[model samples]
Target: MTLHEITYTIKDIQGKGKGLFAARDIKRGECILSEAPLVYVTSNLQEALKSIFVLSKKNAKYFYALCNVHHDISFEFGIMKTNSFPLGQGSTDAAIFRVSSRINHSCDPNVHQSWNPKTKKGHVHASKNIKKGDEILKNYIPILQIQEDRKRLLQENFKFDCRCSACTKPSSERDLIITKVNICTGLVKESAESDPATAIQYVREVLGLLDKIGGICKTSYYYDGYQISAMCSDYSLAQEWANLLLESYQIDE
Candidate 1:
């Protein structure tokens, strides 16, 4: 389907520094409008590919061909390069299309992306009730990071310095976010090697952080729950958290 035909609407997002797709109506999970190529190369000859920006003639031709077949190719490719999440072992050679990308990056985001390789798609769902005009956002990196690191990564990759809530907050508040993130990270790490009692303590601490930050750190809570459940060898609990994560973010199983 064409971009214009899709259920979502493309609209200008403030502070995001780009136009983004927003839902015009409620949409369910696993709804596929388009599947973007993970990597497009013009030349099968690897030597011909030099920079990431320059699509080789062969790849460009392929993209053009796809554009002919798919009306949304240009929009797909534009969003793919701009917001697609990297996949594979390394080098970000592969990417997945996601609504979370449209939401832009925030140190504290209200939505998150969960990739399902089985379906070759990434699902974007709300971490909270997002008002009609609220700019949907996802953390480009782990939510638990110092503002400096978050700013640095977003600037380097997205090419725009973030002006999200956490980024624009006073230095004291930013440090609080960082400190909470650190506490969560430390708890998760220590839980990996410690006794169950210690691990549970860490889990509680992480959950405390989650309560403090609200929806912005939903992904962190989801991950922590999954890890703790797995450590206890409780697949059911793990599955529960996994489902919670998927449901909260509209992730595809």
Candidate 2:
């Protein structure tokens, strides 16, 4: 789909100091857009150079087409670097586009993007009830870190400190949530190296911490948020945690 055809409109995010998409209306699980890359470049330096050389000749028509089609070359290149989605089995080449790259990150984002290699397109979807004027967001980095880490990354990459729910929370409550997140991270690490018997102990510890923090600890980005739910075969809990994650985000089972 062309940029203007998409249902969302770009708007200035409060405190984020960047443009973000906002739903024009309450969109269901509808496909907002499916976009193909104007340019596909590999991550490996040598491979990328080689692909560029090859495309310069083999796909020269398309290459010239992109150069003419896109107005801001530098911005397009930056977006490709920042938001290019991976494609090809065992291949490092990434697909870059305009609309998807405009999406800013959030710890609690309302939209998600999915890449489909067969179709050669990335699908953007609403993950929650995005209000008409709510700035549509997708977490750029994995939101599994504590508040400090999350804030640091946002400031460094996006040039603004996050005002997301977790970042703007009261100091006392934020600290407690961080403590629980730390505990859960430790338990997950321990579980990774422990025997089945010891794994259960770690899992129980994580669940206990989750219970203690209540809603504050229940945000989707926590590292071990779905571990207990997955461990106990609690599909309901697992689904809840899955829904919390941004659409394109993945967790090992």
Candidate 3:
């Protein structure tokens, strides 16, 4: 939809504004859409503003559809600030993807978005199975942090309260997950030498927790699995984690 062919269709979500909805049942790790960015800004507020004015009329229409998180700035700047994603982790350039930008945010997002600098294209992949007609989502804030920080960050930037299951989990369950995550990080670290078997189990536990918390974007644990597995000379486990890691990032052959 929206000038590109995707498995999702554009629909107006009542309180959240526009959102992407699955047009069919989408399996986990499936690529929802892949396309070159509509525009690239050198990841600065000033450059983004200038680009908006130069965008062709056709492109401007799509830009206008994006949400304005910062009302204090020019409309164009707000759109860029709110909608643009990084070229890659810690990159200075920002990318605006047409179809993927329409995807709304959920703490427990069903979809994960990744940018490939080589091809200069963005890919949206299903992190979990999405039933037909379900609204597709992407995380606007880092999901790895404690829920409290995640909520504050979302409110500060996106100007919304996150009611996702992760944020609203019962106090006891929330604490347990956070505690497990912290312990597992050390376990994954030690698995490289001290105990590969324990590391695999720890990473699996962490990944399971991540899925329960609706976080599939951070695949570092998969690399944890692959590294530990390979160190232990477990090729089968290493390959399984490698495949999962690639799919999580929407990397294809």
Best by lDDT: 3
Q: How high is the lDDT of residue 233 in model 2?
A: 74
RMSDs, each prediction?
Answer: 7.2, 7.2, 3.0
lDDT of 1: 0.54
lDDT (10s digit) by residue, model 2, range 1-253: 6544557775554543345555466464556666776566675645544444565454545343231212344543543455555663355777756556667666766666667767878777665666766776777665646677777876665456777665676656646755766776576666643443455455556555555443222333333445555666766766766675433243111
Task: Please identify model 3 stretches exceeding 4 Å from their true place.
Answer: 1-6, 169-171, 190-198, 211-218, 232-237, 247-253
| Model 2 TM-score (2 dp) | 0.58
> Which segments of candidate 1 are over 4 A away from where they belong?
1-7, 13-17, 21-34, 38-84, 88-92, 96-103, 191-193, 218-253
Q: What are the Cα lDDT values of the candidates?
A: 0.54, 0.56, 0.78
How many residue pairs clash (N, CA or C atoms closer than 3 angstroms) in each of the candidate models, in the order given? 4, 0, 0
Question: Quick one: best TM-score, which candidate?
Answer: 3
Better of 2 and 3 by lDDT: 3
Clashes of 1: 4
Q: How many angstroms is residue 234 displaced in model 1 relative to the true structure, after the best TM-score fit?
A: 7.8
What's the CA RMSD of model 1 in angstroms?
7.2
lDDT per residue as tens, model 1, 1-253:
6642443554654544343444544233433234444343222324212333476676554433321112334544443445445543243344533233344566766555555557665555555555444555666676567778777776665667777777787756657755866776676676665665476566667666666666345554677777777878978878987887777555322
